[model samples]
Target: MVQNIKTNLPGQGDEDRKIRERMAKIKHKILVISGKGGVGKSTFAANLAYAFVADGDSAGILDIDIHGPSQGRITGIEGLQMTINPDNSIKPIEKGGVRIVTMASLLQDSDQPVIWRGPLKMKAIKQFLGDIDWGELDWLVIDSPPGTGDEPLSAVQLLPEMDGSVIITQPQDLSLLDARKTVKFSQTIGVKVLGIVENMSGFICPHCGKRTDIFKSGGGKKAAEEMKVPFLGSIPIEPAIMESGEMGKPFVWMFPDAESSKIMKEIAGKIRAELEK
Candidate 1:
């Protein structure tokens, strides 16, 4: 028979207090989440943070993906170890004008699997929030692993005063079905749904400037309307977006002239307006 595990670990109260104190310094907190993976959620999170930074706000990305952390690689800080301050607080790595913390920096090998259970994953996320020296940031974009699981739950429970969450979904029926669940999950947990982003909404031909509905567009906006949440905007699929990530650069910052970049900037601006209001 399986034995019961204690819910309260040692120093749990201390960590909770520390988390509150640290989070208080950040002006706005946004969680980027999806119902399932492979919808460019992480990419959107990274670029969203950069977009805020580009608009003259200090931003940071706390990658809580745990088992599949990609912000380090996407932000171009992979393989860089985090430093500790004399006061014992962990320092976040700064790159491309945004500070970042990810499990990627803690791993000895890139291919090493996280192999952690729910409670263990929660503890790591807590430490990242409470123990890290995030300093004063205008925005903290949290990139949570897809689904309404342990990592996202832990973050939501810890950050009760968070601004809201931005749900990322593709423009397809299968993805839209999961996106609806994601919206309901936010509601069930008492977290406000800031908006839904239709990523990979379409493909823009770079050479001929023709638009192709590769994934069939407008589903995300329709879902947002049905659910009564704001529809942030759509980001088209662009070759440059993929290349920018591979090169450890955010597309919005690296290719400001690209159409995708302009749309992302508009989305960021809407979020900023909502929060600043």
Candidate 2:
């Protein structure tokens, strides 16, 4: 019965000084999970944070889902309500230039329904990872809530040095056995899978263009080559991505030269070339 899960850092409790200042200015903080729901994994963490800010970089999305946030309607920044600076922190919601953060922006009404549990969803994902304001960033996608509970175990216990994790699956076979239990629960907690995306996977038929496996294609790239990891591709089945997430805009920013937005910008350029190895 090992019980000691104390992690505090929402305002000034300096939890390891704000997680070592966000792993020293964030070169990476991926985390775009999945192991249950409809397996879009917050639409691949909002089109990989809009293809990592349209390739210029400096990104940050962080929805943490909180039992269904959907990155404010998939990055259109739905309702847009967060504003509390006077030193209380948390403002995150810029859009277009990235830096999002959401529980639907601390909701006033975005179809409210947090109905919290598990210590208030682990203190609102530890105040969206220590009181928001993820300033300098190359990437911070996040978007969890699809299994391995308590907001991806409070983002791996408030960033136990996170730098990788992306697992989404929808090629069926029961979503490849729940995406191999989210890749063995991120290798039993060390967290660094960085692969396995296969959302929707097939359905180009617009007037018979063929290719429609519907939900049986490749089985998340053969379950990422039998769970070794690193499949990171396939994302078909576009109906303008459900009309650009019902007009909140996000089929990779309204079909950036579609074909599922060029496979979500080549899956955000193979996750920036596997985070430069």
Candidate 3:
């Protein structure tokens, strides 16, 4: 049987101190969150990190989606275990110019499920921020699982210096409704709402080069306006995005010339502008 990993619970003096010391080295931190799932949030977080790297900044991704950690696969580091230094600090896995810390990397088996409670999940997140040797990074993009729950709440409360959050949603009413809630959640927690991203907004037919509103586009922008947050940009549905995820390659890096990639880069630029300001 695999041994259970013990972590210091939040609010412990030493643990909180370590978290602050480590986070201080990072210039900026961003939380990528969504109100509901299946809106391409994790994928956007990975690509955003890659986008920052492409723009000549050092980036790292902290995947706090403890239950469904996909950054390991999304960043091309699947099945790779994180190592420990002589000092007992955990080392994050580096891939494609972005350092990654995810539960997927630590799992002995990829198929194994993380059956953890709220407190256990919070402890694990604290360990990720405090115990890992992240070094200095220009951006630490945290990919949080959907909803206003344990993972997102823990990260925000821990990283008080976080720059802001990027809410992701599809261009549909249902997704927009939850996305509005996410914006409100960020506001409630005192985290800046950097903007909202509309992913899979439209589909581009490769054969005819015609655009189709597969998900009925424009709801994200409308919601952003209604919520008084910036509307970052919209990403169209492209086949290569899925392929890139499966191949462990970031879509923006793999297909820089593609329309979707361009939009993602533009979104990244907007975020940089906001954070740098």
Candidate 4:
């Protein structure tokens, strides 16, 4: 993807300086974060980057979920390793229209644990922003690890001009409680909260053709209203979404014509509109 750059990108000396130089080419950056795990935050981040691809814009997924980096597998680029460029910078692996950068590519084994402390993780994240040759991108969608931990904080601190954050949550109260904390974290950091996405909002029985509140519905929207943030959209719990992930493809692409995909697209559209403002 970086075949046209003629400048000899030198080795990184000062981290902050390098990140400022590299991220300048990216027009927008979105941090997909959640307060807790199992909220499908990474999956949403992957699909969102690909959604931009479907819209004919260049995109990249930076899976900063250090310990559980899933963007490589989710974007169908699992097992692909990062290549070193002649200028001594690491090249991001491309799949379809999205460039994917993940700790998954750096690990020798898929099941190997990261086992890093805060300082180490922060260094790795710094290298991701500073050393990777992301080139010019319309969007850089980052999948931050759950909670307001070092990974997420490091990402926010690195991107001085980050567009904002996209918070993900489920329909239950437990998730909502933590989601509120997420909103507060973004505010405390001076980063704007772009919106919230309610994932696994409802489920439709494939056989009965009936909808069920498997996880209890409407809490996400209610929370957004109470928090005074934009509730982007709700995504139904479709079995195909899970199946698509297991098969290493995004649900939005596998079921582009389905109801879930439409909702996701609408949410993506809403996010784009808000960002363009």
Candidate 4 on 152-266: residue-level lDDT in tens? 7777766757788999999999999987888888877767888889999888999998999989988788878888999998988988887888788898777778888888878
Cα lDDT computed for each candidate against the true fold: 0.89, 0.78, 0.89, 0.85
Error of 4 at 249 (Å): 0.8
Over 4 Å off, model 4 = 1-13
lDDT of 3 by residue, 1-277 (tens): 1111112223659989899889999999999999998789889999999999989999999999999999888888988888899989999999878999999988899898999999899899999999999999999999999888889878877877778999999998989899899998888887889999999989989999999999999999999999999999998888889889989999988988877888888998999888788
TM-scores for all predictions: 0.95, 0.37, 0.95, 0.93
Model 2, CA-based lDDT? 0.78
**Lowest-scoring 10 consecutive residues by lDDT in candidate 3?**
1-10
TM-score of 4: 0.93
Candidate 2, TM-score vs. the true structure?
Answer: 0.37
Q: Which digits, one per residue and each the tens of the lDDT, describe model 1 over residues 1-277?
A: 1111123223458878898889899999999999989899889999999899888999999999999999988889988999999989999999978999999999999899999999899889989999999999999999999898888887877787778899999999988898899998887776789999999999988899899999999999999998899999999888889889988999988987777888888999999998888
Off by over 4 Å in 3: 1-12
The Cα error of candidate 3 at residue 81, in Å, is 1.4
Candidate 2 on 19-104: residue-level lDDT in tens? 56755787888888888886778777887888778778878888877767877877777887878888777778887788888787
